[model samples]
Each structure stands twice: as C-alpha cells, then as structure tokens.
Target: MSLTCGRILELTGNSPKVVVACECLAAGGKTWVLLHERHGNPLASIDFFLKDGFHLDEVLGSSEYDFELVALQPGDRLFMKPCQPHFVFGYAHSICLDPAASHLPNINDFDGLMDLLSACVLVILGNVLDFRTYRAPSQDEYEKANKNQQILIDHEINSIPISERFAICYARGVALRLINWIRMCSEIRGPGGFIITDLPSRFFVQIAQTLIKYKEGANASKLDLQANCTLGMLTKQIENVVEVDLKISSLWSKRHLIPSGSLALANQGDYSVQWPDPGRKKWSSIERDFMDAGVTPLDRLCFDTQHDRQHLELSVVIPQLKSRSSASQHPPKRTKS
Candidate 1:
C-alpha cells in the first residue's frame, strides 16, 4: 500500500495523527518513519526531555534506538507500517517504537522477549525517567505551524525514585514529556498541529550519537559506576534484529528449501521466490533458547532441524551382563564351529 499520499494527508488533517506507512524516499522494503524534535544545531539532535533532565537508562520498556548517519542519506525515505505498536513512556519527549514485525519476520523469533528485556532494564536503571522530549529547530515548514508542539510538556514532576531527593530529577519529568509527545504525534495536524513532520525514522541516529556520549562519559565518571547502558543498548538491538518464533515451527516453512534454492541460483538470473506461512505453533522459552544457542550462525543461514522438529533419537547402552562382543542375537562374523 502506498501510504505516502494518504498518510501525508492523515498527518495534515485536523488532529494530526501519527502516520504508519512506507517511506516514500527509502528503498521499497527497508525503511521506517520516526517523529522527533529537531534541536537548534544543524547537526545537533537533542530532545527537550534530555535538556529538561530525563535520564534514559533503559527502564520500563525504555531502550535507546540508534542509527548511524552514514546509513541515512538526503531524501532517503522511511517506510512506515501502521500495525506496529508505539508506546509512550512517562516523559513527554521520549517515545519507543516497539518491534515492527521484528524487522525480520522471516528469521528471528523474539516474541514476548522484548517485554522481559524492558522489565530487566527498568529494574537495573532505577532512576530512569518516564517522559519523552524533542528540542530541535523545525526541519520542515509544516512543523512551523505547530511550533507550540512544545506546550504539551507540563512542569508537574512525579515523586519518583527517592535516593538523593535533591539530585536533579530528569527521568520522570522528561518521560512525562515523551508520553505527551506521542499523544501529539497521534493528534497534531491541519490548522493547528504537527504540520508536516511525520514520524522521523532517523530518530535512532540521534539516539545513537547520545549513547556514544553516554558510554564515553561513563568511562570518565569518578565513581566508577557500573553503567548498564551498553548492555541495554545491545538487548534493544537484538530485539530489533531477532523475530519471535511466531509460528508453531515454521518461518514460512518449506521455508526449509526456499532460501537455499535462492542462493543456488546466484549463477542464474536475479533470485525470486515467495515465503509462505506454515501453520500456528507454540514453543516454550527453553525451546527457543536451545535453538538459538545451538545454531552457530554461518555466512549462509543454516538450521539445526532437531530444534524445531521431533525425530527418531538413537542411543545404545550395554548392560553389565551382556558379553563384551555382544551382537543382536546373531553369531560373530567368519566364526567356524
């Protein structure tokens, strides 16, 4: 579906809504859209929540999404799909884009895994704030119409994480802003709204830059605090790349031979084949863990069939009473009586 025009229209109408559609400028299948605030610096992409004191230490379904600048180019489009879930944190400036079909529906099986990871992050990063923010100059003219987009942020800070009650409280306030920001994304438009800045898919790139700073800063911290930021980022990356074992035992089964065949034809014309869905399946966490752990990823994808299927298993054990050269009730070979 060409979400370009209709999506843009939806974004432009009254109550400007967050749009879900393919990026017009991006290559057909591999683009996503994200909406973010543009800080003043041409290259500086900071969010208002960050400036207002929101610490994103990976808590409560909060993980920083990063993207490299090189990966994005001028006019590159972001493909937005409507079905993906977008959750707003406690802050007004931060918003998390949940797994969009794992971005690898054909390979990974990370269903329900993100939620656990989100929980882990929250546990570790106790002082995490809950809102979202954006603090950049408007990138498009449409945004100019609703420059007041910043108003959604309220000053009421929540009584969160009581440690150094005086230590600058950034998490909750910013998280609140982030939540409101999402609300605006789903509502901004027309005579008085978000204007034309649909979701900025490049938001990850901004987050990545910030994370780099977070890492370097940790290294230089005087307290030698064991920052869990790096690990949290990794988990988010894995979550993005891996897919849930969505089906009972199939990633578009027959799935077995489809991709292999595609590779075999490299010597021929451009590869082409459609992956069909296998029936529904239910797998446990242990099963998934076993499959992931057992499969040593190779240059070309390979599978340990046993992980997803049940076949005849063979094991031979000799009893203490059995003869040393035991046979299956048969005489020894070449034995002359």
Candidate 2:
C-alpha cells in the first residue's frame, strides 16, 4: 500500500508477520507498536479500546501503556510478533508488502504446536465473548450465549476443508482447549459466572505429599474435595494421611503455582500462603482456596519443603573442610614426618 506524507494507519492486531518496504522511504517513515506481552492474561478484545473513545496517539504516548516507535527505510523489514497492536505512518509515498506468515519458535519437538493452539484458543475466546461487549448475564442468557458459542464453533469447524488433515487436527485441539477455558470462566453462584452456570462443586485432585523439589520420587495420593474448601482445610486432610507437619507454605498446581509477587521469595522458601496479600487475614483468611485459584477436577498439587521446619538441612560448613589457604598457612608440620 502507498501512503501520502503524514498518512497514518489505524491500529490492527493479527497473526505474526513481516512487513517489507518495496521502495526507499521518502523522509519520515515510522510504525508505532504496542505488544500484549503478558502471558498470564488473555488478549484484550479490540472492542475494549474502540468502545472507550480513546485517541491512538494520546494513549500510545501515555506512560501507562508501553509501546515502541520504529523507523523504517528502503529494504528495511519490520517484524511484528503475534497479536501485537500497531499503526504505521509514511512521510513519503512508499510501497510495502505484508504477507502474514507463521514463525516457528525454538521448541524442536512439537515445533511450536502449543503456541499455535494458544493462538487458536484466543481467537475462539474472542468469538465466545462476542468481542467482550457483554458481561455477567442471567441464567437464560448464559445458556443462550453458550449455545451461540457452540454454533459458532460448529460453523468454523465445518468451514475447514476435510482434505486438510493438519487443519482438522488443529481445529479439534482448539475445541478441547476452548472447553477447558470456558469451564474455568464459569462461576455460577453469583455474578462470577461469565458465561456458563451451575457447575458441579465436587471434584478430585492428586496431592503429592513430598516437596515440589523432590516430585520425581514423591508418592501422590488422590483426594475428593469441594469447591468451597479452603487451603487450610485441605492441608489438614493431607496431614492426617501423610503423618507429617505441613506448613501453609508454597503449594503448586499443574501449570501455575507461584503468584507474581511471590516469585522472588520462592527460591528462599518464603512462599505466600495467601492470595492478594500474604499477611492479611481478611477475604476468607490469608490462604487461597481452590475456587479462588480456579483449581478444577484432576488438577495436581505439590508442596515445597523449604517452609517445613522438620526437614533436615544438609549443608557442610566450608571452613570445617580442608582448604588451600589453611594448608598454605599451617604447612601440616611435615618436619615431624
């Protein structure tokens, strides 16, 4: 596309791609980019920004939003990461080619299969939420919304050609992953349920009695639990079977365990036993329960040993061992020998 002087493009986010300029840029050519880099949170819907009546330049310039300004010239290539929000401005008449392509990641075994699946899940989630326009509907509305989501999924799956075996497989994986996310988002008792309602509260989880550091040799036991049970209650149950003292220390789930604030202290064995704040007793006590962390059925849990007082410390004082400095200073009294 050719752009006149001072012409600016609107914001857009799509698959990863490389934009190559066909001709030399006249005088001032630049692209402003804002990337959604936080892995913990889902990508914000486009409607989220447009509906808020925000000016692109103003928001981009603000300190609250992190963005990058890139200058491009003749033969220059601008590589945009997956799902990044960006706009372009050309000072002079210039031509460019943008062919959206998938870039392979460093993983060799699956060849970035998980990344592709994640992108698919994001796309499906956007469709499920109707571009994030609505929130917290009644029971009837929730059921109707889910039905719409299923219809959309069916239409999408049918759109893929049957001959494309790889594409079919990908669509199936996306469907399964989407189901897991929908379940997590569904909290029926109150306004918490975003889409689905009245899910079962009882579930099974595998509890590993050993410390997380020694998970390889740990003995895992299965337990039944209710969604309303707190972390402190669960700890007591494990204590009865394991016959050991347990601390409200670091407990880990299958994929995520440590909170963002507790990451630095994890290595020091000072894991936060509570949610939001470690020391506060408010909000149903300090310890976070299964419902708060969204621990569904069949999720795995493990403990960290550093917080346990009974665990023996295995360390040898280096001063108690023979050293080159001590040997040089004493000389071992070799004359006696």
Best by TM-score: 2
RMSD of 1: 25.6
Q: Can you tell me which runs of candidate 2 are displaced by over 4 Å?
A: 1-30, 35-56, 59-62, 65-67, 80-85, 88-102, 105-113, 129-337
lDDT of 2 by residue, 1-337 (tens): 5553221122237743332322234434555455442323333332223222234555443323444677787656554444456666655556554333323332222213233334433332221213111211221322323565444322232122223323333343344343343234322222332321211111011112221212211112222222222243333333322221011122223213322311011122221111123212232322422222321111112112222312433233454454756877788654765
Over 56-105, each residue of candidate 1 has an lDDT whose tens digit, in order, gives: 33322232342212122324433332323223222122122322343322
- Relative to the true structure, candidate 2 has a C-alpha RMSD (angstroms) of 25.1
Clashes of 1: 70
Best by lDDT: 2
Query: How much is the lDDT of residue 253 in candidate 1?
Result: 29
Instruction: Score candidate 1 by TM-score against the native.
Output: 0.19
Give stretches of model 1 more than 4 Å off: 1-196, 200-205, 227-337
